[model samples]
Target: MALVPMETALQRLLEDVGPLDGESVPLKDAYDRVLAESIVALRTQPPFDASAMDGYAMQGADAQTTDGELAVIGEVAAGSTFSGSVEAGQCVRIFTGAPLPAGTDTVVIQENVDRPADGVIRLREPTAAGRNVRRAGLDFTTGDLLVEKGHLMRASALSLAASANHARLKVVKRPLVAIIATGDELCLPGSELGPGQIISSNSYGIAAAARAVGADVLDLGIAPDREDAISALVKQAVAAGADVIVTSGGASVGDHDLVHKVLTREGMTLDFWRIAMRPGKPLMFGRMDNIRCLGLPGNPVASLVCSQLFLKPLLARLGGRTFHQDIRTATLGAPVSANDHRQDYVRAAIEERDGQLIATPFGVQDSSMLRTMAASGGLVIRAPFQPASEIGDPCQLMMIG
Candidate 1:
């Protein structure tokens, strides 16, 4: 079979995938969720003209001249309304947020006024109309669109939604991913390793990647190199309503590789296998009914690289979120050899020096070297069939972390 190119594999993996159905959630629980529908204001903000400062409300005409003395007819605070109207030489002492008096069009701040006698105040400075007053509907009017659909809710968005009188919000449902690790030579972390047994570490990184794209994860634990064990876990994933099922290892043609056989027997229509990429050439993708399945390589670095390249984007689309690769151009800090038929993603350390990005690839790029992959700052992309290059050559880099 011809190896699928990376771009073609990604396109097929994300084909026709869309956000899940909407569900209502309380305002406090809506943070970081994608809005399913646009939020419209139910009531206008500052429904009535109100004071913006602690001051005296009076007719604008009466405060146009300096040394203007006006009798305090009454007082009003926040949530309180003045009963009588204000006339010339008459004012109402008002606090912030109090409704403007019926006949008053301006407020002289307390700092700019003087209380010379009881029930009487003098304007120390001339004031203009509408000063220190918030007009009706100043922030937003009723029926105004405040937040559009597909927007990710943040702190400001939640506050705006609350101010728009929305106690609950319709948000896209988070995608659920089920992860399974396969192999008889694998054991959980912190366990005494028997002969030929290594700790299973890919699930942790894969789960974190899924969550970074807003997908929930269910770790199905380790499955021995047996068809029955693997098949049982696959069935459990389906019964758990997983939107995507991710399996680590057992994707190649080796004797112990049973993921491919089990998935096909379970009625998964194989989409593609063996991508034209280094380190992760044995990658596989398929679908079973409504659930998508991905078979990743056993090597730790290969699994993580494939997850960042493919799984993240697929989950982002299914969760109604946007994802973009942080690709950058950089100069190679060391010489590199020519590429083969497979595209290469060489792990490297990247630094910014003298206004230019310098990428230095590690000496050994073994896919099983998890420490090197963890320390890598980025991946230097090498196109297939490319010629050999030397230091200072321009290259494309995909930033990690």
Candidate 2:
């Protein structure tokens, strides 16, 4: 099969993907979840005209000037109301958030009133009608939409929803991705490695990538380089109702590569097998019914780069969130050789100098070197068949940091 262009592969992978079904969750647990339904106000904010400050509430005309003394008819605090109305030349001692007594149109802040006697106060400043008062439905009226669908629940959204009297929220279900590592030579970290064995590290990075896009992860541990071993894990992922199954290693055409054959045998329809990109050329994508199956390259750096390039966006879409790679323009800090036919994603150190971004690629960009990938802040993109470039040349970068 021919290698697929990077753009073509991405388009095919995300062609029909969409947000999952909605599930109701408590408001406390809704933070960072995408809303499946717009949040509507169940009750009006400041359901009644209320005081916005600690002051004396009276008719605005009653305290137009500082000379007149008004009799304090009663006192009202937040959560309590005065049963009687304020007559002419009368005021109520009201605290912040207290409901305005009948016949009162304004509040003279305590700072602007002087209490000459227990029942009399003289205004130092004139408060206009509705001044220091929160009118009924001041923030939002009942049935008004406060947050739109597809919005992410952040601190402000949660607070607004709670103020609108919402105890529960409808949010898109977070996508679940089941990950499997396949290779006889791969072992868990901290294991006493047999000769030629290496630590299985891809699943950790892949899981982190999945979570950063709001997808829940299920690691199925390491599967040996055998079809039956891989098939069992694949079936487990299906049984667990995972929306996506990510398999690390076994994507290439080598004899030990069994992921493609096993997934196809398990009823997955191969969407694509190889990509026209450096390090991640063996990338595989398929579908088994509703589940998306992605086979990433075995090399550690390739696995992580592919995860950043592909898995994040897929999971973000499934979780009802928007995602875009942090690609930017930068000048090369050093000279770079010409690229091959395949597109290149060179790991580089990114720094800003004199308001311009500079990307200096590492000397060796071998796919197997995880240390270089970790140390690099971004990937400098080189299009296919681009000529050799010199220092200060303009280039596009996909920022990772």
Q: Whose lDDT is greatest here?
A: 2
Clashes per candidate, residues 3 or more apart or on different chains: 0, 0
Of the candidates shown, which would achieve the greatest TM-score relative to the real structure?
A: 2
Instruction: Tell me the tens digit of each residue's lDDT in model 1 across 1-401.
Output: 99999889999999999999899999999999999999999999989999999999999887787765799999999988988888889999999999999999899999988888999888788989878899999999999999999999999999999998999999999999999999999999999999999999999999999999889999999999999999999999999999999999999989999999999999899999999998899999999998999999999999999999999999999989999999999999988899999999999988899999999989899999999898899999999988988999999999995
The C-alpha stretches of model 1 lying farther than 4 A from their native spots are: none
Model 2, range 1-401, lDDT digits (tens) per residue? 99999999999999999999999999999999999999999999989999999999999887677777999989999999999988989999999999999999899999998888889999887777778899999999999999999999999999999999999999999999999999999989999999999999999999999999999999999999989999999999999999999999999989999999999999999999999999899999999999999999999999999999899999999999999999999999989999988999999998999999999999999999998899898999999999999999999999998
Query: Which TM-score value belongs to model 1?
Result: 0.97
Model 1: which ten-residue window has the lowest total lDDT? 60-69
Q: What TM-score does each of the candidates earn?
A: 0.97, 0.99
TM for candidate 2 is 0.99
